[model samples]
Structures are given as C-alpha cells and as structure tokens.
Target: MTKPVAIKRRIGRPPKEDSVETSNRIIDTAAQLFAAQGYAATSMEQVASACNAGKDTIYRRFPSKADLFGAVVDRLRAGVLENLENEINTIADSGDALERLRHLAKWFLSVNLRPEMVAFKRIAMSEAVVFGSAGQGQTDKDPIMDRLVGVVEDAQRDGLLCGDNSTVIANHLIHSIVFGPSNHAMLGGKQYDDPAIRDQYFDQAWKLFLHGAGQ
Candidate 1:
C-alpha cells in the first residue's frame, strides 16, 4: 500500500494601513516618472521600484502602465476641477458678476500655475492631438471647463457678460486665464511657482475681458 502525504498552504497576512500609503506612493512615483520621461518611455517596473513596491503589487492595483498613467491623469484632472469648483462656489458674496469673474480668473490662474497641473498639460500637449479624442466627442468639454462655462452662462444672464454666445466667451476666458499662461510657461521652460506672477496675469486678463464685455 502507498501512503500519501498532505501539505498545508500558508495564508498571507492582510495588508496593513500602509497599503494605501504604498498605493499613493506608487501613483506619485508614476506621475513624476511620466512627467520627467514621456508616458511611452516610463515603465511599470520603474514605477514599482521607485515606490519601493513589488511588480505584482503595481499590477494588483493597476493592470498595466497605460492604466496607471490614465489614473494619474484622471487624478490631476479631478483635483484641478475640484479646486476650481471650490473657488467658484466661494464667489457667493462677490456682490456682482464682474467681481465674481475676477475672482474666477484669479482662482483659475492660481490652480493652473501649480507644478502638477503644468506637468499634466505638458504631457497632454506632447501627445500632439492624440489625447484630444481619447474620450467623448466633445474634446473641449472637460469637467473643469464645463463648470467654467456654466459660470460664464450665469454671468451672462446676470448682465455681467455681454455676448451673443456665452459658450464662446467662456472658451476665450478659460483659454486666456488657464491654458494660455500654462502653455506659455511650458513652452518657455519657465517655472510658475510665484503667486505674484499669477495674480498679475489674472488681474490684467480679467480687467481686459471685463472692460470689453461690461455695460
């Protein structure tokens, strides 16, 4: 008669609270890597190593490098949108549409000038139009831009803005306050760390646009 031996499998310990910290570290490492090196150049292994995590851990959280990069982009986008929304909501006591618009422009500049945002925009622009069609047909209608448009529409209804097309005005305002400055800095190899510069640009842009649209 032959005797069979049974082997017991060992169970792994549950992940600790530091699991979330590790995940965030991986994400942050990926963001920096992707920003320093283009998305096509950055690798999941590098991200894992940078985060002091295992390859399997990265795969467990994000299936692929592309997936992880997409998540990073999404986080940056959502953060910018949330900051802008909070700024807009704070305009409740501005007393007039023009002041609110000024506040909006200032807030827009403040948010856009952040290094993370600038890096995200740089990454998006480097793809040279591929990023434009990655989502819905409306390429220009991101959550943050949509919220800004809503604000512009409200301002128009309140007679703070005068234009046959509110959407067009909103686009122009966003381009001027957000994309224009960021693009300029990115193209010129300039750092946008100084709040004073942002405030100055915001003031000038807001005043010019308000003057043109004011009654």
Candidate 2:
C-alpha cells in the first residue's frame, strides 16, 4: 500500500496582509504616536515602523501626514462619541435626569482625563492657536455637541432642569464639567487623572450646575 503522501505545508508568509487588520493596526499605531508626540512631531516613518509596515504601504494608505492625523483623530472621536451615546441611551426614563447627568459627567471626566486624550487635547489646542484651524476642523465635525444638546433637552422636559435654551444649558454643562477640570490640568493646575481630585471636582461641579440651572 502506498503510504499517504506527506502533507506539504507552506513555510513562507502569506502573499498579502489582512487588509482590515493591517489598516486598523496602522491607525492605532498612528493614534498612539500622534497622541504621544503631537502631529508636528510624529513622522510617517515612525508610524510605519511601529506598525511593522513599509513607508510605501503607509503612504499608499494615508497619502500625507495630515491625512494620517485626521484618520487618527477621527478614530478617537468615533470611540469617545459612540461610548457616550451608548451610556446616555441606556438611561431609563424613570431614572432621575440629574442622576443620569451625573453618570454622564463621570464618564466624560474619565475619558477626558486619560493620558492619550490629555496629550491630544494639548496638541489640538496648541495647533488651533498656532496653526489657526488645523485642528479645529475636526472639532467642528464632531456630533458630541449635538448629542449633549439632546440630553439637555431631555432634562428640561423631565423638569430636572428648568431651562428653555438647551444650547446654552448644554454648553454650560460641557464647559463646566468636562472642560473645567481638563482645562485646569492642561494649564498645569491640579491633575485631573487623580481619582480623588477628579471625583471632588465632579461633585462640586454637579452641585454648582444644578443650583445654577434651578434643578
């Protein structure tokens, strides 16, 4: 009987990389680099090396440094906005509106205080001021402001907040709870990443907001 022919396995790598996985890895690596080094400081070669991809591959995918930076910012914004939407959507109608706001506040603070986000914020603000709209376009495109307005409307309807202008209320809430501490940290004040400091600020901000809003 002829012995079963030995199975010959290919030893070499696949001819093509998995496009989706490779693209995601590239974006992720670019995001880390951009967050850590800022847009001006991060180079395409660095991203390529970090992703284990060639310069040609990165150039073929991103075309330019601005394109790569936009992609990274888009990725970060998508994740943050998606998570915020998911959390807000899960709030029960029967639940106290202010309590929902508190939950959102906590989530917002945690996200904004993360190292990557902190770094990105520093870079974005600097670019916006110095480069004059280089980083501002991404913020203009984000739907987070709209989402926050919707939540503010809900609170108004629930009578938890007595405000006819959802836009003003939403802006106040965002600026107070989200930007206040984060901006403080950005300006070399108390560190927003510390749990104790963050929680204290959140609580104070919440109380101050409710009182100011006539909640």
Candidate 3:
C-alpha cells in the first residue's frame, strides 16, 4: 500500500535561455525598424510584430518605448566599445604615438560608419537634443572618449604630441577624424561608400591631425 509517492515539480523562474533569446530578437528587430523608420515613427507594436512577439512581452522586458529605444542604442554602442577595446589591445605594442592613434582612429571610423550605427547615432543625437540626455541607462561620459584621452596623455608624456590639455588634444583629433565622415554618411552621402575612398579620406585626415597636434 506504500507503493506510490507523489513528488511535486519545482515551479520557479524559467530558464534564462528563453529570456535572452527573446531579448535579442526584440533588440535586433527594434534596431532595424528604428533605423529604417526613424525613432519618432517606430512604435512598440511594430517591434513586437517584427519580433512575432506579443506587446506584453516588450512591456514586460522594457517598461516604455524610451526604454526599448535606449536598449537598442546601448547594445549598439556596447558592441562598438568592445571592438574598440580590442583594437586598443591589438595596437598596444606599437611604439609611435601618432601611429598608435592612427590605428585606433581607423578602427573607430570603420565601425561607426556601419549603416546601423549611423542610424542609431542619428536617432540618439536627436533624442539628446530634445531631452538633454539619451535617457534610461545612458551616461553623459563617453568611455571611448576617456580612452582616447588616455592615449593622448600617454603620447604627450612621451613628447610625441604637445598640448596643454590632452583632453582637448584628443577631442580635436577625434572630431576631425570622425565628424566629417560620420555626418556625411548619416546624411546619406555616397562619397565614402567605397572603402578605397574612405581610406584615402582617413589617411589625409590623419596626416592633417599629426601636423596640427604632433610635436
């Protein structure tokens, strides 16, 4: 009679795989839609539809549209940040200050000029202009900019560059190297579409940067 004993199955939090999979799908779909439609026009419902997910799914993961958009922006920048850190490590053995910065600058432009990044930047900048910040998990400090400043400071210590403020020096170099190409690409300018032309532009910019900031 003591033959059968019933065991209760554990009911707890679900496996992380499902949550992660859904999160990635939502983010990827939102990125494409926001990039294609502009942030103002893209809606959560559209994102959910693209993800083949319910609206509740998005709301559960991200509290609001701003939150979801911020997630998209964060993920894009995070990926580039990781790659840029790798680029920094890859060039750590280089002895020339300007040359080291040159490698970093090239990597920066190549990654940021990707169509998806350009779209995200355009939207994020628009958000910042109106809201004073790209709210919800965004910080005013640019980690890449901080790392750029570090490189410039190291160059200054080596007397490879001259500047009263290495921060300003680094800022000038980055803006010169990135702003024109980034702005043009964001506006759909076709001039830098070819890698050859892009490299030519970068080389010319690097030379000019050296002339102005190198010692």
Candidate 4:
C-alpha cells in the first residue's frame, strides 16, 4: 500500500511583512485610488483589494477611511519633497541661484499640470472643505516650502536677489506661479492641455518670479 503521501502545508502567517512595507503598500494603493476616484469615491475595501491585502490589515494601519486618505496625502507630500531635494542636490554647490529658481518654477509647473496630480489636488481641496485637512500639516512649514525658502536665501546670500524674507518670497512663488496656474488647469481652462500653451505659461511665470525676486 503506497500509503498516503504526506502533504506539506504553507507555513503560518505566510511570511509577515515588516510594518513599513505593509504601511507603504497601503498608503500607495490608497493614494492612487483617491487620485483616480476622489476621496468620496474611494473605499478601504477597494484599497485593500487593489493591494491584495486584507481589509483588516489596512484597518490595522489606518483606523478610519479618513485616516487612510490622510496617510496617502502625507506620503504624496513627502514624495514631492524628496524629489525636490534630489533635484536640488543636482545643482553645483555654487550654482546660479537664478537658474535654481527657474528650475524650481519649471518643476512646479510640470508636476502641477500632471493629470493625476491635478486630480489629487482637487480631491484634497474638496476633502479639506468637507473634513478640514484630512490630517495634512500646514503647508507653510512643509519641507518643500522650506527648501524653496532656502533657495531664496541662497540667492540673497549671493547678492543675486535681495530679500530679507525668504519665507514670504517662497509663499509668493508657490501661490502665484504654482497654485494659480494649477487651479486654472484644474478648472479646464482653454489651452491648458496644450504643451505649447503650458510652456508659454511656465516661461511667463519664470520671468515673473525672476522679476519678483529682484533679479
């Protein structure tokens, strides 16, 4: 009798993921869904299913749907800051401050004009109106803003752009060039989807930023 061959079962817990891996997957998945469908449309179940994770696993990391959405926004904000930092690192230690400002202005326009980012921004604004921020921190003190301020300060140090208030300059750069155009694009303004038009807007914004900085 060829006795019944013993069957091996896959081990317990199926190899636990470190907390960071699990949390990152959840946050990334949530961010994509929220960006695509908006905060009101995305659900925790959809996020879990899309990530191939269990609902309980997601809930363990994010106690509520709003918490999950907030995590996604925080992660996106961090990623944008990290990219900005990487771009800053590419500049020579004694690089042109004006060039740096132009690079940042271009980057801001490109990122904001992205469809997914536009959707995310719209969703964030809506969520902010409904639930008051979805746990994102004050934009004034964000690392990205800080980095922009640093760029302005460096320009001041080089006597390229005289400004005693880098923070105010940074705020102006963001609101005028980045946020204003982004809002217009999000509203489906004419010619927004055209690359030539986008380039024109970016160039105009760059020129304005340079002038505003006293260059």
Candidate 5:
C-alpha cells in the first residue's frame, strides 16, 4: 500500500483584498469613462484599459455594461444624498423651514450643475430614449429622495409645514426646484455662477413650495 501523504497548502495573495481593490478600481474607471463618453458609447474594453486591467477583470466585477452604468449612477446618487444630509443637519432652528429649504435647494442645484452630474444626466436621458418607458424603474428610489423625505417629515412634525405625505411632497418640491436650473444647464446656457442668481432662484422655490405647505 502506498504511504498516505499530507497535502501542503500554499500561501498567496489574499482573494478578499484583491477583490476589494479591483472592484473599487473598476467602479472609478467606469464612472470616469461613462461621464466622459456617455453610457451608451462607453465599453468594457475602455473601462478595463483605463483601469489597466483586462476585460475579464471588469466582467468579474460587473456582468455587463448596464450593470457598470448602474453602479456609477448609484455612486452619484449617494454623493447627492450625503450633501443633502449635511445641509439639512446644519439647520439650527425648526422655525426657519423656509431658510432651510432655500439652502438645501441652492446646494442641490450646485451639485446638479457639476460637470460630472451634467454628463451623467445627459447619458441617462439618452439611454431613456433608447430604452423607452421601461427604463424609468431603473432610476427609482434614489437616496437623495429618501433624505429629502426625512427633512420634509421633520418640518411637518415641527409644525412648520402641513403636508400629510411628506415623501410625495418632497418629490414634488425637489422636482420643481431643480427643473429649471438643470434644463438651463442642459441647454448650454451660461453657468449660473453668480451667487445672487442662485439665491434668487432658491428663494423663489422656497417661497412657492412653503407657501402651499407652511402652517
């Protein structure tokens, strides 16, 4: 009978560490490429090249281009929510709901006006046209919406507003506030660089949204 031999295990690079770093690199590269080239035009090969990895490496992290695009969208959405949360927490007094709303709106517009945000929005719009109504659900439940809902709920509870459904009201308010500014940028108009212009726009949105809901 052959003698039984113990198998020896070899130590190598940790799989977990490699996975984490590779995923991050893929996400970063995808975001940059998608923003610069638009979602439909960017390819896995380009992303892999940008990250100095193989196409198989990107595929290991994201099964398809659509999946990678979704990841990029998620990152941008998270950033918007973080900025909104920071702005909302800075509100010292509950009675200053109008002021708080103005600040939040202005900050939100500033974020939306960023080059990366503009590029992302344009890509999304283009993709929506190609994908039709079916694409709508893909954009649902953004973190920024959740943060805005929380802020609206707090205002209502503080007796600063009278909205019964804070989530719906928050959606409407944010949509109205951002629509004009985003459209203007999308049209290639001069950037709203003047602080006064931003303030005026936010003030109007604040007045309009609060006038209907204020106690």
Candidate 6:
C-alpha cells in the first residue's frame, strides 16, 4: 500500500509575529463586538475569545477592559472619518468656497448619511455615556466639523458668506445638513435610501444656506 497522498494546506495570515500586528488584530475584533453590543456590556474575555487570542495576549496589550474599549473607539473613529477629514480640508482650501460647499453638500448627504455611518454615530453617542474616565485620547472630534468651520471662515473672507461667528454659521450649516437626514436614516430611513431624493433635499438646503448666510 502507498502512503496517503500528502495533504496540501493554505494557511491564513502568518501567525502574529510582532506587537503592532497583535494589537491591530485585537482592536479590529474589539471594534465589531463593541459596535454590536455597546461598551459596558462587552468585556475583555469576550474580545479575547472572539479574536481567538489568549487573555494574556490581550492583557499585555491592554491592561483593562476600558483600555480595550477605548482602542476600539479610536479604531472605529479613524476608519469612519479620516478620509472625509482630509478631503474636506483639501477641497475647502483649493477653490471657490461656495462651489466647494455645494459639492460637499451633495457628497455629504450621499455618503455620510448611509446606514453604517448613522449606526456608528448613534451607538457611539450612547456608548460614550459610559466611557467615563477611560483616559483614551479623544477618539475623534465632531469629524470634519472644524474643517467645515474653517471653510466657512474662508467663505466669509471672500464675501461668499457674511458672518461674524464663523463657528456658529458652520454649526448651523453642517447640523442642518447632517442631523435631521441622518436621524431619519439611523432609524432605518434618506439620501442613502434614494439618491434622487437626497439630491433634491440638498439643493433646497444649499440654496437656503447660501441665501441666509449671504445676507
């Protein structure tokens, strides 16, 4: 009798060989659990089990459950908003600010109001209630909010907008665009469901913003 044919197997990503690789794997797994279960309800033991990592591995990287939760938040924040932050800064500084604003309005309602983003924003706020004193470097800040405000300030200088408090004006514009539509979408509904409707809404909102801010 011949020996059994050799079994060929393709292994997955090579076993974690370094600290950074290990930390990333843990954070990715932790983010999914936290998003689905919320912070207080999740634990390090669960994270270790979910990631197929040992408790010792997790503890060595994050000494506490809160630390792990904080890592999850940071990772989620970067994944969700980093690109938008960079894009807004570049577009705002590059050309006709009002035209940029119009383009941004269309793009914003189209992408940022999607189900995934709305879900993240809603759950993140609820979870933050219990994020008390974690000492986690602020996960993210009203992502793109400051950049939008700066754009408005630039628009004012160019006389496209007339406003004394650029921050307040920015807040009004951004909030009006995001909150109501995103709120509807979060509950299982906006632009995300239908692009035509979203564009229609954006056109009206954009016109109104320009009319009011130009005054």
Number of the predicted model whose TM-score against the real structure is largest: 3
Model 6 earns a TM-score of 0.75
Q: Per-residue lDDT of 1-215 in model 4, one digit per residue for the tens? A: 79999999976554556667888888888878887788888888899999999998888779899778777767777888898898888874645997787787678777888877787778766767644546645454577778888888888888888668889887877777777778986776646678888888888876776675463
Candidate 2, 1-215: lDDT as tens digits: 99999998967643465666777899999988887778788898999899899998788778877777777777888889998888887875646776776787678888887777787788778776533433445445448778777777777887888968988887887788888778876775667667888889888988888886463
Query: Could you tell me the lDDT of residue 23 within candidate 2?
Result: 74
lDDT of 1 by residue, 38-82 (tens): 766888988988888999989988887666877788777777777
The per-model lDDT (C-alpha) reads 0.74, 0.78, 0.83, 0.78, 0.75, 0.73
lDDT per residue as tens, model 6, 21-74: 889999888878776776767789899999899999899889997787767656
Q: In model 5, how many backbone clashes occur?
A: 0
TM-score of 3: 0.86
Pairs that clash in candidate 1: none
Candidate 5 global CA lDDT score: 0.75
Ranking by TM-score: 3, 4, 2, 5, 1, 6
Cα lDDT of candidate 1 equals 0.74
User: Which digits, one per residue and each the tens of the lDDT, describe model 3 over residues 153-200?
Assistant: 878888888878988888898798989999998888878879999999
lDDT of 5 by residue, 45-147 (tens): 8888889998877787787777778777777777777777777777746446645655666677788888788888877777885334323356465677777
Candidate number with the higher TM-score (2 or 5) = 2
| Model 5 lowest lDDT segment of ten | 130-139
Which parts of model 3 have CA positions greater than 4 angstroms off? 1-13, 126-137, 213-215
